[model samples]
Target: MHPSTLLQLALMGLFVASIPLTMVWLSADANKYRKLVWVMAFLTFDLIVFGGFTRLTDSGLGCPDWPGCYGAANPFIAHEQIAAAEALMPTGPVTKVKAWIEMIHRYLAMGIGVLIMALMFQSVRQWRKTHQQAFAPALPVALFLFVCVQGAFGAWTVTLKLQPVIVTIHLLLGMGLLAMLVWLGGREDYLLHPPAPSRDLAGLRALRTLALLAAIVVVLQIALGGWVSTNYATLACDEFPLCDGKFIPEMDFEHGFTLWRELGKTAAGHYLQFSALVAIHWVHRNFAMIVALVLGLAAWRAARQPALRKTAKLIAAVLLAQLFTGIATVFFDFPLAIAVLHNAGAALLVLLVTMLNYKVKHLLDVSQRTPANADLPANSYR
Candidate 1:
């Protein structure tokens, strides 16, 4: 929290971000902005997955501080404090490894912030130079703002002692940021390779609606899953197909769904019951079926379309992998590797669904254009 510590953190972020910024500068891609967006999207995906690893490993409070480890720039500098904490409670949260894990996640997040700043700067500059709608700073600026909000949540996650609601919201915001980036990247993709006109207007409209709906469903399911994870309810049911060998076990929905409370505590500050954890886990487990159905239907519909066949195949593949990992995580007692992949699968689903939505929208736009407006530049529609 000291000024020097803050400066050191900032410098570290710049150092980490420079690698990707240099890649974008040196690349011969005709559109560096597009390349940067794609790269940013990729890193954001990694951050979200690593975030899951952090949470899963109980490393969220490893540092037990914000933006720095033990009020220092890195774990090395805070070694003494971390060691003392670990010695005091060997199996507790502030071990040296957890501190490193937490700091690494923070560093990666800070690096991402630097990249967004660069993106926003370039976007604003390009918009001023060309006055093109594609270069409009709105989305990039919004991304910048969203990342800021996400960072605030990150801070709260630690300072608030990993409150269930705060932690769950943190996870949701990270996913939301990835979705936004994917949508932005999809827009760039269309500009890079404009889709051809589609004769099937009704079909395109239906697919677009389905894709949008699928995205909404995925987001909600992710919220449920986040709640399950944050509440440490992954093993509450401990079995697949049926939870604890019952179709509907006893549950405490009122405490389980309470919005504002400390970790493992209900609104009344009493210890959360096992029934509440079962309720949280049970809801997420069952809701996976709904997510699978909707996304599967969307993928099925898209697979039949020549234009969306590739994206559709991706959605199907990731959806299957997501289901496998979700089940495997439970059957295998939430193995770290499988669990992280499950989280990664969710982020990938978001990316693919957003891409499908954009593709369908592009085709619909092409189909809707008439002779009078068909001549307008594609950027105009954007």
Candidate 2:
């Protein structure tokens, strides 16, 4: 929290971000802008996965501070404080290992923030030089602002003692950042390789609707999944197909759905009951079925379109993987690796859905233009 500590953290973040920026500069690819966007997207995805790892390992409070470990820039410098905390509670959240995990997650997040800043800087410079709308600075600016907000939530996740709502929103914001980057990258790709004009307006409209619906379903499922994780409800049911070995198990939905409560407590500050945990897990479990059915239908419909077949395949594959990991978490009592992969799978699904949406929107844009340019050849739009 000190000024010097903040400066040190910022420098560390810049140093980590420089590695990828250096790679982007050295690459032979002509479209460095697109490459940088994609690289950021890739790193953002990794950050989300590492974040899951951090949460699953119970390292969120490893430092008991934000943006630094125990008011120190690095865990090494904060060793005395961390050791004292561990001495007080050896098996608690402030162990040396957990501090390192928490710091690493923060470092990655800061690195991403640096990259986004660089992106905004580059976008502005390019737009000024070229005066081209294609080189617009809007998205990079928006991303910079969004990452700032995400960073705030990240701090709150630690400072608020892992309040379920704050933590869930943190997770959702991270995925939302990834989704935005993927859309930006997809937009760059479309600019580089415009698709041929399409006459299938009706088909495009249908796929667009399905893709949008699928994206909505995925976001809701992710929110539910986040709630489950934040509330530590993964092992509440401890069985498959039926919760507590019954079709209608007793649950406390009123307490379970209390959005603003602290972790492990009801709205009225009472210790959360097992029934509430069961309710959280049960809703997430049942919703998975609905998400699967809806996304499966969307993927099938998408696969029927020749242009979107590959994206559709990816959606199907990720959906199946998600289902496996979801069930495996229950069957295996929520192993760390499997649980993290479940989070990664959710991020992947968001990426795929965003891609599908972009592709369908691209097609729809072409379709709308096709009628006006009907005198030209189909390939002329490209």
Candidate 3:
């Protein structure tokens, strides 16, 4: 948090951000804004995945400080402090490797922040030139603000000692950033190739609603998963189809669902009950059924529409992979690799569902705009 450390962090962010900025500048694509949007989207996705890796490794508090490592810019400078922490507790959170992992995650996040700032600037400049909706600066500006808030939560994750709610919200906000970026990219893609008039206006309208519902369900499932992870309840049950040898599995939802308590503690400052952990794991496990059903239905409906077949396939594939990873983590005792994949799968689902939503809305719009569709009945497309 010192001035020198702040300067070093700023330079690091700029250096990391310059890679994509340079790529966008030199690309053959005429719409550099779209290119930049997508590059940030990809980087944001990486950030989310790396974040999961950091958490899975119990490295969230590696640096034990925000924006820097032990008041230094990098782990090397803070080696003495980290070493002391590790020396005090050999297997604790502040080991040298963990400090590196946590700092790298922070560096990537800062780099993404710089890219979002660039996006907002580019959007404003482009809007001044063309005044097109695609280049509107509002969402970019909002992204800028949102990332700042997310960064705050990142700091709180460490300073508050990884309070479950704070960490969970931080993960959710990262996913929200990905959702916004994907939607923005989709907007640019739509502008580049507008949709053709749909032959089934009413069908698309219904599918749009379903896609939206799927997204909501996925988000909820993610929230539950985050709760389970942050609370270290992933192994509470240790069995798939049955939780602790019973479908119901004794659970304490009252303490488990308490929103604002510290990690592993009840609101009354008592240690959380084992049943509470069971409740956390149980709900996430069962709710996945709803997620599969809703996403499967959306994918099925979208697959029937030629324009959406590819995206539908991706949704279905990722869904299966996600479910498999989730179950594997249980059967395999939550290996780090599979656990990280489970998180990545969730992010991919968010991206795919957002894409589905965008395409359906576009198709519905195209159908409504056709002159021949004016006299069509409620269920008619032709």
Candidate 4:
């Protein structure tokens, strides 16, 4: 990397780090490690949003490669190569805007990696002092490993030509990272305010089951959305509430749902047909309806529980936002803004679900509940 490029990378890294650092310093709980975790969690959410922007703006392939764009640390150094690629394919995915978007996403991701490293360091210090491993340093260690895997999939997302399955996994992994960080943050928050007793012992168990159901369905929806994007099928059906103006418009499920092949390719390896794209879009559209109903019902049930109302309402609100953004994407021809919001909404949903699951799980463990709220137990956040 050139001196200037390296300087840019360093400056960007510092700028990204500063956001959370300020939050940590200014928090009411300053000097508390939990504050640091909350800052990381907030920034993780921002990273998820920026990631959506990168994908929506067609920047996933902006660098034309991974880790470093065009074998350089920053786009400034790789400008010439990016220009050449764009010139060869004018409307292709490697323009200057896309490059910036991609690089910015990478920078944010790197910042997160650094923060998680800091978290691990803090956890190790705490664990050594306490000499107990209940809330072991291994939690941070696991997160570190997970993000590295996510970075690998991020690379493959570009290098492998955005293969649907890989891209889909990449999307899910990003969400997984956010959810994990949220859980870590939730642990800290829960530590401050003990865990509430399960509203109904059986209902509490059912909550876990409902959350799991929500997760599986959301994953399926996201995967379907990825398939739609990878195949360039956003406009496959212009009219929503119905596909191409019918209960079921023409489709090529065999081609659309064919799992193991390059992106934009049919099962047998030919260029994908429009109907196949329609099939992909259509399935995601319809499946979303079922997912929304299930999740809405789950959140409503959660709301009925005195301990879970606030989060349940939050989950419900985000789900509605997701539905709106999703419908807007189709009615509005998949504008970049709506598309990004849709992705962000999906990430938010995943995080909320994970927190709900984690919280309820702790409630089930009676010993860990907090003392301030004696009725509830403190989950071990050591």
Best by lDDT: 3
- Report every candidate's CA lDDT: 0.91, 0.91, 0.93, 0.80
Runs off by more than 4 Å, candidate 2: 372-382
- The TM-score values for the models, in the order shown, are 0.96, 0.97, 0.97, 0.88
Question: Which wins on TM-score, candidate 1 or candidate 2?
Answer: 2
For model 2, residues 1-382, the per-residue Cα lDDT tens digits are 7999999999999999999999999999999999999999999999999999999999999999888898899999999999999999999989999999999999999999999999999999999999766578998999999999999999899999999999999999999999999999988988888887766667778889989999999999999999999999999899898888897799999999999988899889999999999999999999998899989998998887777889999999999999999999999988888999999999999999999999999878976876565564423434
Q: By how many angstroms RMSD does model 1 differ from the true structure?
A: 3.2
Question: Model 3: per-residue lDDT, tens digit, 59-157?
Answer: 999999888999999999999999999999999988999999999999999999999999999899989999999999999999999999999999999
Model 1 over residues 202-260: C-alpha lDDT tens digits? 66788888999999999999999999999999999988888878999999999999989
TM-score: model 1 vs. ground truth = 0.96
The reply for model 4, stretches above 4 Å from the true place, is 1-15, 22-28, 132-135, 196-199, 367-382
Model 1 residue 101 lDDT? 94
* Model 2: lowest-lDDT 10 consecutive positions: 373-382
Residue 313 of model 2 has an lDDT of: 97
The RMSD of every model to the true structure, in order and in angstroms, is 3.2, 1.9, 2.1, 3.9
Determine which window of 10 residues in candidate 4 has minimal summed lDDT.
373-382
lDDT score, candidate 1, position 45: 95
lDDT, candidate 4, at 243: 83
